[model samples]
Target: MIDHPPFALFIRGSKVDAFAVSDQLGFETGMEALAVSLFEDGPETMHVQALFETQAQAEACLDGLKFPSDMESFITQLPDEDWISKSQAGLPPVKAGRFWLYGTHDADNIPSNVPFPIEINAGLAFGTGHHGTTKGCLLIFDKLLESGFKPKRVLDLGCGAGVLAIAAAKALQQDILATDIDQDAVDVTLQNALANNVSEFVKSYQADGFDSPELKGQRFDLIFANILAKPLMGLAPDIAHALAPDGKVILSGILNEQAEMVSDAFTKKGLEVSPQPSLSGWTSLLGQKP
Candidate 1:
């Protein structure tokens, strides 16, 4: 595939099988893919669209996918004009606390009296603020706030668009450090923070796991990590060490079964994993160092 700035791929096939294939490929290989399963205007046939960064990457991944003998698929690159126009369209609004998150297109329309409004245009970033993992963490964070729980310092690991950091900064009005492995994500996070006028309260950095030299030996009253199971496990030590006594930790983006392994890693480091809350088969684990 040509090295297009913002590439997109479309795949249509047996919707269920296509989703399964897409998910397997994503989790196993960390491919850039998004599966959309839908029924057309009528239910005669199911449809699946798997978006990818490059036509050749999508094709190569699909070539190795093990589908049933009868399963079928068609792949093509979306026209540049269509892709650009569609991507430039409005994004659905996201809300947590009194904050409202809008994309660039919608930010201009937000009312001035609102408590907070942030333009979180992710561009080609992996997170778009629509995933269940993200929404679940927001819900749990809401519950914590409703109960009047407050933490002084906050950190968002694998911050993506920095939604979690933005949420924490809005809630605590404290210094928030949001870090991601991808520089694009760091830029997106900073842009979102500025749009919300929390650029002073929330800082963005490009860091993965414990590789962030600035975070070394630092401690926070709260930490939110919404990464996958493997990295979550690998960072258990850093997470535990960086947390203050009685610090609260929130984690997501892993399934129920995988939670045990992740929880165990943290537990061995003296953090106690609380019960998990389930959403669409994925699990969010809460822990505290006490």
Candidate 2:
């Protein structure tokens, strides 16, 4: 009478993860869990399982399993190796034909154009055009361009892989500064900038969260940040501090349910929040400082 989603890690079950399991449990031997079989044996008595975030959590759940000693002989772990994938595994377009956004691996397929093709080689970082939240930001920013907001300067925060930064540079005629807490992401963004020929337009920096001394007293005509909800709330002061009066901002990477919370954070700092459509369940926000 329980629906337990086992906390599972994605390792080929019988291999390292099994070894890790035995080591973690202080057991002399380890056996991988065999897949459930629904055969003509008897009743389809199901084994209980649940997902735990860590090994400790998994062990705790294991402690609750009530496997009768008589039934233990029927269970066994199968080999974890798997190779049942289709040809479409690497076929690009995590979600197809939506204006070619380059988030995760986006730099590899940079968008092309006459004005300029802002190539961005994104890696394991978040906030490429592929993620729903990032794509939502791009859509709104496109509208900003359509509305004739000619920005001379732009700033992108939490610039994972600098995808948004590159897009703003190419879309708005260059002149961008992108920052991220992770140095690897910064490196990837610069590489993408160089690839897309927007190197001149984009600059990069590294900081913890958003309170770097390097960015103090700086303001921009356009600002973009696609970070998650909680940190974005904490960043209200810094965001407001960096945006120019009368400038506009495009914020994303928040769920629709939490949009109001993020909006309130900015509203208290004098940034006017307006609703942009949700991409998937995440919210995109637009605001202006007058």
Candidate 3:
């Protein structure tokens, strides 16, 4: 098969506007992947990058969008290269709480004191532990583990690359149900679980939200959902229903300004919600089902 270059459509604007555009592109264009990052010029500026398999698709998606007057938008074809490896090459090992997340390059340098050393390399899926949302979830979960919160049934919703599921499996030595909307992500998660030597403890499935048979009539003692804020809010009732009594939920992929809105959504579903420390302009919320 011939190799094809990926195309990226970029939008630059204020943080709020950038997030809005990101959400819009995700919902409307059906792009392969989307990311939001702080612009290099300053923290106040935000950049939204949407990746597509074809240049035509990127251009068409860009043309369909009605961006704000102040926002800037454009499309560029990336070089045909191992972009995933190139992008991940510079990422140093991230130490979140007690969990040590490292790509293969840092495998030899893992500290002796770290109990849970998870080897994850950036790939087609998300959550290599570098993103603020993923790191925040790991930090919060690590603290929970430190506090003697032993959960028997664990679920990693929107498992992405299965970093959270792998971490829980490594620390708890318990089965972790990992689910994601994309099949590629499910495959990647399972591969990562095997790479981390936790395949026996991690089960992965491709499910849209809570619709999969694997999640039917299941109640989890601990759940992690590091998805976008809008989807997180919409899934509040389902998530609340899936939690066992006194169960805990870690939520991320939310902007700092939108934290309260997401928290209120879960609160309305009878969950006692609290915000974790904001990281890199993103917010993570912890909720308990009373």
Candidate 4:
């Protein structure tokens, strides 16, 4: 038997275009982990990194690529350390209103005062409740729950890691459609849901923003979308169409400067937008279909 060590691949470019490219690659590549971020101390530089199961896999994937002229690439052996566990261990538990989110590494550390505790481990996908956008969405979900809103039909669009969907399922004890454009994200969501013991309430699928036949005729009383600004604006009509009468929609992943544009798109679709508190420059909006 032979052991194959994993490899780490990275590319660097400007954040604006590089981030988008990195995101597309992340969705399509099925890497163990992929991330795009601005390089600290160098605001203009962006980094896109991916981890592959083997060096051969990484090289083969990169060989078939059409990287931009300015994009520089690097491949190296991934360290033997348990990076995932170590990374998850560093994230402190976060409280969003009544909900307390902690990774499995700190499961035993959950406070006694926290009423709703969600266990989310760091995985190949997003939404560990660390990102501002995710936190904002969680806060919106908490507020909705506190308001006595019981949505029997729920949809979590672009539900990376399925945190929002899991939260809704646990809170409402109802079926939830968790869809993501990436199949890997769908798998990760299912895994996370099972880990949180909410798998019975959550179902996942790979769909490009309501394109799946599974979602075509179905309407949801509550829809949660914690995706980017452009996609959120573009999907406004689809979201509105899929929403049941008097239904609620929670929108996050909009930068502070882009919130107005996103809000206007949904508002024009007959949704009355209610602003939620911003966290770390991200805005979360709650809307009601009238």
Taking all chains together, each candidate's TM-score versus the true structure is: 0.72, 0.64, 0.83, 0.85
Candidate 3 per-residue lDDT over residues 47-130, each given as its tens digit: 767667778877888877777888988889878797555545767899999899998878899999998999987655767888
Candidate 2 lDDT, 1-290, residue by residue in tens = 11332233222232212222322222111223211111112222212222233455445435534333333222122233231111112224433222454333334555454233343322334444645677787778777887878878788887876778877777765679898876666777888878767899889988775458657777888888887677788888878777888888888767677899999999999988998877656688998988
Between candidates 2 and 4, which one is better according to lDDT?
4
Can you write out model 4's per-residue Cα lDDT over 157-192, one digit (the tens) per residue? 989889999888888888899998888889989998
Enumerate residue pairs that collide in model 4: none
TM-score: which is higher, 2 or 3?
3
- lDDT scores of the candidates, listed in order: 0.69, 0.59, 0.84, 0.79
Q: Residue 38 deviation, candidate 1, in Å?
A: 14
Error of model 2, residue 278, in angstroms: 0.8
Q: Report the C-alpha lDDT of model 1 over 264-285, residue by residue, as the tens digit.
A: 8989999989756676556788
Give candidate 2 regions above 4 Å deviation. Answer: 1-91, 94-99, 102-122
Q: Please list the residue runs of candidate 3 whose C-alpha ends up more than 4 Å from where it truly belongs after superposition.
A: 1-9, 14-41, 48-71, 75-85
Residue 43 in model 3: shift from native, Å? 2.0
lDDT of 2: 0.59
Clash count (model 1, backbone only)? 0
Q: Top lDDT: which candidate number?
A: 3
